[model samples]
Target: MGAASLVALLRYSDWHSWLGYMQQPYLWRVVRFSLWQALLSSGISLLIAIPVASCLIHRSFYGRAALLQLFSVSMVVPTIVAILGLVVVYGRSGWLYQLFDIHIPLYGLVGILLAHVFFNMPLAVRLLLQGYDLIPSGQWRQASQLGFSRWTAFRWIEWHYLKKVLPGAFVLIFMLCFSSFAVVLSLGGGPKFSTLEVAIYQALRFDFDLNKASFLALLQVSICTLFAVVVYRIAPVNRQDVSLLAVKRYSLKDSFWAKSADALALLVAFILVIPPFLAIFDPVFSPIFLLTLQSAALWKAVLVSLQIAFPAALVSLLLGVSFCVLARFCMARRYLALLPNKIEHLGNLILMVPGLVIATGLFLFLRDLGWGFQSSYWIVVWVNAVMALPFVLRALMPVMYQQERRFRAVYLSLGVRSWSRWCLEWPLIRLSVAQALGYALLLSLGDMGVIALFGSQGLVSLPLYLFQLIGAYRLEEGACVAVVLILLCLLLFYGSTRFIGGRSLVKH
Candidate 1:
């Protein structure tokens, strides 16, 4: 589908037209802003995550476990939902502004930065915390026995893991922020602050400029692909390792300043994460909650959201499993030695390609091939499945590889073929499969990228409906929708994890 879209784009757009669009100063501004905001967001997220992760690592406070779970929730919260939460805290009529008579401009670059940090910081913290958690208990004991200073401990022990993981985390966050569409569209205030993703939307939906949209899509692919290549070179492929069972810790100074810093870090993290939880209450108390329940459109949107999410997630899981199986088989056979690496590269490439770019490419390709607008439902499903591929692969590949290595010899010796092999592996891999499906479902449920382009009155998913409610100045109804959407996401995520052996799958 991606290849077909690119082919159509090249076929439909002329080199001269692409050159003309590229030469425009505003186009360059869009590129510049995309890179600038992504850089800042990634940098800020990492900077703040380090201390917060350290605090989480060292301190054993009440509610610490619940706080970590909240971080997990933050990682999967929908982008639009998170943006609404930010507005409740920082908008013109928001609590902070109205109470303090202070304005922080929730509709421009500042808002963009704040939103990106809110969404990505938890992810960074979680990733970095995992890196911290993986340190050998013996190493921690040695460091403590040696009375290593904080800086010395960091330099010798902590820095090694951070240095290995941080680049990948930064690249992941940067790609997310760079390709962002819904967040920028809702909060950017106008085109003066637009990114390339928004520009493609404007060109296709409003301007009806296919040439311009195709050119911008090509540009987006080029930049993102470059970043993907760099990440491939720098970030090591993640592997699951058997580790010592004992919990380990490196004692901190416990001095006044150190305690104060840890307290401050926790405080900052609380402030950053609390608004979304609080925002859920707004619609519950508001009269709009009843109205939203009574409204048929709300139910229709919910049904539509489920319709898209289930199929997309199922397809994503199947593809992820197939890829893992194929890669494992190729590795075992030693046939096509580069095939597994290429497949890995393909997953990275898909990660870099924004949903908007794929939507644009597919839209152009479909239209050129005489598929009408009605094909958008399928398009949304296909693009969303592809978008979910990387996550599914990430969650399943490690487990699949581990299972293959552990069982291959046994299966061969026992002659466990076909149905027998399936029976043997099902118990081990079911949780990973469920995890991938759940993650994919959450992603599809919250997506606003391709849906923003293809959605119509006839086909309204929950995110699209929520966006509509916001656009139509129905703030109360929008709040209600936001609450419902968030709850549904949490319910799906929690249910899937629970059904798939609960915390075991979640940890994986």
Candidate 2:
């Protein structure tokens, strides 16, 4: 990665090109808008999340778990599908226009902000909810005995921990919004709302300007590194505790105002996430649906998507498990010290290197090497794998380490070595492994970043095909494709999670 960064830097080191590009007012506008929108998106997401999280912890109602699951889905719901869903509701001739006769300017900054909030606010709510779990039950008991009002309890008890979580959550959502691509591309409408990621893609794919692409990638890396450092330093980890169910404050009676506020916040979150998803299903009944299904191009794109997803997922799982094993081995010795921690951190550090930046670097390098589109296939896979690595490690590292810690001596004493050891361990951790792999597969399948830059007519994946369909305003066809993509994501996600991991022995 360092070598790629340096190579990108050196290739774009010509001061004249830098000065000329920097002189363009449009570039500065993009930079400023990127920062401004990210700030707004993060700030807005947190503002909304705080109340929602509070309501959730204050009261556990029916469907709350499902709502939390839905929140998790927002983060991984295939960007193009989410964008298409958004367009269905907020576009000029969409749901609002047809039903209410309201036309939102859904093609520009407004749409961009809507899309960012739709994708990110639920994530903020989930993260903030975790912060609530960190609060001790004793505090709630004290509040109950003292007859604390909702506001008073929140001010004195909950706010204390929630504030600790705010900085990390804000930075994370900001980084996601800053590097956003699919939303910007679909709804940005034009250069007025483009982000750095979009600008980098334009330079590489449309303009074919290697120097410009490299320069943008370098800038992106520098900014991302600053935020990544903050993330590392803050290191907020909000784990669930069983005590979250304890000591519901008896003093906190539901007032009409509190009920109204919680209802509104939850309604806002529900409307934000559900409508777009439901809207995606609109075309399933249309005549174009069957036609799209029969189209060879659609099927071919599906095949191509699988072609990328399978290998990319395998590579991610292999790399993640390998890192966990090595990290655990080092931890066992204790002399190797932070080698384990460093390895764990290095695996996640992939997040700081945005997918497009990595692709841009690889794209530039491949061009210099005279590599053709044949090898671009592998490059896309490699980039997608790297992009999913952090998630895979997040799923695997804890479970993998725990299995080793609990079972290592037993397995060693019983002479479970090599193949025997792996077989023994496989079932124990396959649930996590399958989940991680499933996530990687979905990520690779849904990716528009690497493939967008490398995509050619001959190399179209499902997402790129759907993107093209949406771009041409073929709503009928795009809806059909969106349904297929969503089904594929869910099917594969569960197939791996349930079938590969086997059903949980724990009775629900």
Candidate 3:
């Protein structure tokens, strides 16, 4: 992953053209719009997420469990599929128009912001809600005994919790929105709204301007790398519990007005998050659904998607395990302590230079080498695996590191070695491992970035196939494919987490 990405970015140097490209007005627009949208998206998501998480934490509601689950779902919905749903609801001719004579003009920055908030706000809420679990019950008891009003309780208690988690969540969401591709590509409308990622794609794919694409890819990498360094310097106030299910929280009593406010927040979040999913699935009742489902091409795409997903997941786990093992080894020793963190940051290099940029860089490199279409499949697989590495490592590292720190000496003295050691360890690490594998698989399966560059007659994954269906103006077929993709992702994620992880995972 490191070699290919770095080599492709650097090997074919055209510094003079790159300098000229930097001066282009189009380049500045892409850079300015990319940063602006990411900033807006992150700021807006955090503001909304705080109140929603507060509602979930303080107010007991009838459908709270289901609503929390739906928030998690928003995080996993394929980007393109989600955009399709957003378009169906917000486009000039969509549900809003037909039902209420309202049009959102979802072809530019407005649509991009809506799509980003839909995906990210719920995620931000989930992360924020977890922060409350880290707060001791004693604090809540203290507030109760002090006869603290809701405002006072929030100031002393909830704000403290939010302060701890908010920065990390904002950084995560900002990186996501900044490096966003599909949302901007599908909803950006045209050049006026294009981001760096979209501009890179257009330069390489349509304009055939290799110099411009390479320059843009390098520029994108530079900006992300700067942010990654800054993020590393700012240590997180707390380590969040990564859980798939809704967290169980201790209840807080609210006054009628407070309860009303919480209810209003929940209602807004529901209206924002749920409608697109419902809109996308509405095609299930259409007459053409069966026709779309029965096509051999559709099945072939599914098979291809699975083939890519499995191998990519395995490879991700292998790399992640290697990094964790090395980090654990480093942490166990005194002198090599800093190396462990530095090693982890190396895995994060992929985040700075995203899969799309890498794909373009390699596409440029491979074209120079005269490689044919057959290479695209393996390239996609490799990139997907690498792309998934950071996620896999996040899931595995803390659990593995904690186990080693606590148990290594005990095991050594007891002569608990090899198979026995694994037996002792499996139950402790299995859930984390299973979740990591599931997430990696889901990411690869739903990925549109790598596949977009490499997709051909022989290289169609499900996302690529769905993109083609939409491109041909086949909305019914596109929705069918989208539905299948969503079902496949959800079922696979559930199966991996439930069966492999041994039970439904609940954190506090």
Best by TM-score: 1
How many pairs collide in each candidate, listed in order?
Answer: 0, 0, 0
**What C-alpha lDDT do the candidate models reach, one value each?**
0.80, 0.79, 0.79
Candidate with better TM-score, 1 vs 3: 1
lDDT of 1 by residue, 1-508 (tens): 5666666666767778667776799999999999999999999989989988887877788888778767767766778888888998988888888888889988999999998888889878977875775577888889888887666777898888777778767877888889888889989999788999889888878887877877888888899888767876877654433443235576855567667878998888888888757866577988668878898999999999999998999898888888987887776676575577567557746756667667777877778789989889999999999988877875676567666666777887988776677778777777767767877998899999888888998779999999888889998889889999988988987787678634563321
Clashing residue pairs in candidate 1 (N, C-alpha, C atoms within 3 angstroms): none
lDDT tens per residue, model 3, 343-394: 7768866776667667766666777789756578878888889988876875
Q: Sort the candidates on TM-score, descending order.
A: 1, 3, 2
* Pairs that collide, model 2: none
Give the RMSD in angstroms, all C-alphas superposed, for model 1.
Answer: 3.1
**Where's the lowest-lDDT run of ten residues in candidate 2?**
238-247
Judge candidate 2 against the unseen true structure and give its global Cα lDDT, from 0 to 1: 0.79
TM-score of 3: 0.88
Winner on TM-score between 2 and 3 is 3
lDDT leader: 1
lDDT of 3: 0.79
